[model samples]
Target: MAQFYRLRVHHRQTGEIHDLTVASDRYILHQAEHQGYELPFSCRNGACTSCAVRIRSGEVFQPEAVGLSQELRDRGYALLCVSYARSDLEVETQDEDEVYELQFGRYFGGGRVRFGLPLEDD
Candidate 1:
């Protein structure tokens, strides 16, 4: 069965709000990337809380979140990059406040940098 995650994000800066629909099994970063949302993230793994946020409403699953202290977890802080939604959720994070869009081509070096010979061209 396919899974879906509904997210409501509140921007702390401009007080703007965004409703996002993410896949339940996929990392939140994928959703952010697909939607062109700027998330302050260094490590995409659960070791970093760069994507941390407070769960304003709903439930999420963190399978490998090590950086989240007990107090922080209790306080609703979570790493959005690693967490998967169990239900429709509302989150408040820094990303919404200072939204940034990530250019996919820049990081992957575009299609110019070849990994192997282009079979189609040959």
Candidate 2:
């Protein structure tokens, strides 16, 4: 049996709020888009954090959100491109740069790159 959940989306960047019904079996982003609401997203395959949102209330299931680390997930962050509503959900879009910084800022390099292997002629 399929279940449906009410989703409340808070687009923080635009200050737009949308209330939509989403199914538990499909990607929330897809459903939201179909319902005529626009949301930030990139790399819909769950490999990027462009569609990241913060879960304010209720629960979402995101088994394929590989772009998010357990640390972020534990902190109530989710990638809407791959998330499914497990229950009535309230998610607010995160600032793209903020989420990216939180997720990968530490890994940024401050030094020049040095290659150990010589370039081969093609």
Candidate 3:
């Protein structure tokens, strides 16, 4: 039998709060979209941070969320496109830039050099 859980989403950009029921086996973003709530998303395959959210309470399983590191997942970050509700969930939508920064900001503007390029010699 499939289990259903209450999902509360707080949209930071629009200041909207959405309450919905989601099946444990379904993706939250997909469920939200089905119910006519427009959420921010770029890639629906969990390859980007456009659908990132922070888990305020409860748990989610997102084994396919490659956009987020394990460290960030441990810190309660999840990609809604690939996440499954493990229990009743409360999540706050995150800014795309904020989540991107949290994921790869350290590697940016660090004075790193490219090894293989047209203008550079190997």
lDDT of 2 by residue, 20-80 (tens): 9999999999999999999999899998888999999999889999999989999999999
Better model by TM-score, 1 or 3?
3
Runs in model 3 deviating more than 4 A are 109-122
List the candidate numbers ranked by lDDT, top first.
Answer: 3, 2, 1
**Candidate 2's error at 115, in angstroms?**
8.2
- What global local distance difference test value does model 1 have? 0.70
Q: Rank the candidates by TM-score, best first.
A: 3, 2, 1
- Per-residue lDDT of 12-78 in model 1, one digit per residue for the tens? 6457787889878877766877897765566778676567777889888886777666666776777
TM-score of candidate 3 versus the correct structure, residues matched by position: 0.89
Q: How far is candidate 1 from the true structure (C-alpha RMSD, Å)?
A: 11.8
Question: For candidate 3, which ten residues in a row score worst on lDDT?
Answer: 113-122
- What lDDT, from 0 to 1, does candidate 2 have? 0.91
Error of 1 at 101 (Å): 27
- TM-scores for all predictions: 0.68, 0.87, 0.89
Which is the winner by lDDT between candidate 2 and candidate 3? 3
